[model samples]
Target: MNTISVQEADFDVGAEIEALSAGRCDVGAVASFVGLVRADTLAGGGDEVSAMTLEHYPGMTEKSLEAIVAEADGRWRLLGTRVIHRFGRLVPGERIVFVGVASSHRGDAFAACEFIMDYLKTRAPFWKKEDTPAGGRWVDAREADDSAAARWAK
Candidate 1:
């Protein structure tokens, strides 16, 4: 089953993976990625990030994530895919996003997992505001993320 959930609560990675591949003998490989909130700011502020708040446009966010997964499904022979993105207030070490893909082959599963995360970094409609010692600041889109996503365009 393909699942896409956007919630404020944290999720269990093991449970998600188990659910994705349960009773599926054909799934030989499973790849997953989990994104977390960092305690330090990467924006060169030299300040500690205490927490962060994520916001999204509800319906649009889910649609965009589903589209990304569909694109991956079109590209690979995937058995199943699951994407979960968390919003609202969160502290460092908390998970922000999770992407998992199951496939018959390792290569397809790895590539699909990476592809979904790359697109999520650039295409998702989520916004983040970090609470740092310096003050609250909106996280800017990084050129590195754009470049990473662009590589999969080919």
Candidate 2:
């Protein structure tokens, strides 16, 4: 089973992973990633990020996420995958995103999880704004993220 969700409520990683591979005896490995809002960063003058708000086009965002997972599935032998992203106001240390992959081997599960996250970082149509002492500033796309996504190019 594949699960994709864009929500404002926080999620339980363990529950999602369990749901993804539930009753699937063939699954041997499950890889998961949980992204959290960082309070401190070197992005702008090493300011402390107090809070963040994320926005996205509802239908468009889910489609982009599904496409990313589809790409990963095509590249790896995945038994199941789950992606959950949160929007709206969030404070530092709050969970932001979750990616889970289940496969018969660790290699495929690991690679597919990373691939989905890398692509989501660059390809997903989500906009973020961080609140700092200086004020709220829109987050810019990181070239490093682009570079990471580019590695999967054929």
lDDT of each: 0.93, 0.92
Per-residue alpha-carbon lDDT of candidate 2 for residues 33-144, written as tens digits (9 for 90 to 100): 9999988776456688899999998898999999998888899999999999999999998999999999999999999999999999998889999998889989989999
Q: What is residue 92's positional error in candidate 1, in angstroms?
A: 0.3
Show the colliding residue pairs in model 1: none
In angstroms, what RMSD does candidate 1 have relative to the true structure? 1.3
Once fitted onto the true fold, the runs of candidate 2 whose alpha carbons sit more than 4 angstroms away are 41-46
Alpha-carbon TM-score of each model against the true structure: 0.96, 0.95
What C-alpha lDDT does candidate 1 achieve relative to the native structure?
Answer: 0.93
Best candidate per lDDT, number? 1
Please estimate how well model 2 matches the true structure, expressed as its whole-model Cα lDDT.
0.92
- CA RMSD for every model? 1.3, 1.5
Best by TM-score: 1
Instruction: State how far residue 48 of model 1 sits from its true place (Å).
Output: 0.4
Clashes of each: 0, 0
